[model samples]
Target: MRTREEQQSDPYPTTVEIHCLNQFLMEDWDEEWDRISEELEEQDIPVPEGYYEIQKQILDLHQDMSVVEILESEEDDDGEMWYTIIDVEEQKIHPGMPRYALMFADKPYSTDIFLDNVFRHDMRVPDSLFPQTWKNRQAAKYQNM
Candidate 1:
């Protein structure tokens, strides 16, 4: 039988392996996206809205995209910090587009933080906050874009 000292000295095996694999897969996905984007642009394709969605999926599988894993931190108001895990193949449905999907976290802690931090302020304000005319204008922009 191993002594307490022996167990303490030995590091966990599976965790390290998993971490390495995650890192490798993320790098591979990044490279793949670069190549795919170039090809799409060269083909004069409008780069389907689904492209980002698929990239998000790839990042999800490799644990590379947006997620909110709460961490214990003194600085956090709730003593929890957010972390994200990305996996490929997970589809996110958007409000405007049905066929188009985005790659977003399976779970997010703060909608504000997710929009501001994770999405880099790219999200539109909730429709309730906008006037009917403004909403229609925004919709038109999306349709035309």
Candidate 2:
């Protein structure tokens, strides 16, 4: 586990290694975005470019979600760290689990740490549970950058 100070000082500051199982749900955005976009297009509704590329997707557990497990975290050929997460039940249901997805550390995801631990917190990741001091520090750090 990386300390909060270390995470804050990191140049990239987009990688995180979670303990094991963490609950998360997609926040502020629908997981069925593509399908929704298609429906909107069919209805002649114009979709904004902001929703085009998927980046910094929020992850907070939905009420319907059972369990989310962090299988592993590894960097890709491009040196981008990607964490493999899977739905436990989904994997059991389908061998080729469609719910399995790669999550970037830069993205938003909910964790129980804020309610329990703070020394290992990462301010770069947005979460309402994070202390205000850490949030302010993160903001200032980015402003200077």
Candidate 3:
């Protein structure tokens, strides 16, 4: 491993900073959906048809098979710290896996920080946290991009 000096010279953005960007992304996401819904409804068009085209045309998804949402919130102002990406077609393989996530807070000591947080709501004592052997394949989506 590199010494402390090496780590400092090649600094990576911390988790919390990435979380802040996701907060803004979620807000823009909701507002965009709301605007599209309103336009579709005003024109008396089917939601699915309008939404699909608008997502690709206006939102720039280029297809009609992906979904994005904050992990736990009903509105943009809810200030949730995590978000997920869903590929509807790939759901058959994992059933209902949360594809990926990004979060904010102090950087963690272990790579499994998010998985650990999922099992125990408590965060004060790290040792008290139970071991989760379940397979986890995840990483930061851009801690600050």
Candidate 4:
């Protein structure tokens, strides 16, 4: 194992642990699809027929996939740290998967951190929040972008 001094000297000190949101968050796939479709509509993008079915099949496989690479890390306007990650293993296996995710940094594996905050972007869709419940959560909950 690297010594503390060595670890501290490293430019990139991120220790990426493999974790799945599926284990922590009970996602409503219907609400997720609805949010995605609405986001698409707002952007004037066409929602392809059968897109929801395709997304369902992809998310079903996400339970075991956790090979993520942090592509970018930034703090939003509210000062919450968020990381834009790419699911490397899933991308290698299937390009159709929503491989890009924007995840909260403070609570990377917490269900509360992901409450209506999980956003996924893929080749077919833009950065869209899934399973959104803005009505229930506070306005701050919707400011992760």
Residue 5 error, candidate 3, Å: 28
**What stretches of model 3 exceed 4 Å from their correct place?**
1-27, 49-145
lDDT of all the models against the reference? 0.38, 0.43, 0.37, 0.46
Candidate of highest lDDT: 4
lDDT of 2 at 58: 36
RMSD of each: 17.9, 15.9, 20.7, 20.1
Ranking by lDDT: 4, 2, 1, 3
In the range 5-114, model 3's lDDT, one tens digit per residue, is: 44467644544222222222333555665697899789998766455545434433222223222223222344422334322333321111211223223444535655
**Candidate 3 residue pairs in backbone clash:** 16-104, 16-105, 18-143
Candidate 2: clashing pairs of residues: 24-60, 24-61, 25-60, 25-61
Off by over 4 Å in 1: 1-28, 54-145
TM-score of structure candidate 2: 0.27
lDDT of 1 by residue, 2-79 (tens): 112343676333222111123322434446657977998899989766777785455446644322111111224654
Candidate 2: which stretches are off by over 4 Å? Answer: 1-35, 52-65, 69-86, 89-145
**How do the residues 1-145 of candidate 4 rate in per-residue lDDT, one tens digit apiece?**
1222443665233533433344222345336756977898999998688876686566556654354444445565776555444455564221112322222233255445455756655656333454455344545676775
* Candidate 1: residue pairs that collide: 57-88, 57-89, 58-88, 60-86, 60-87, 60-88, 61-87, 61-88, 67-84, 69-83
lDDT for model 4, on a 0 to 1 scale? Answer: 0.46
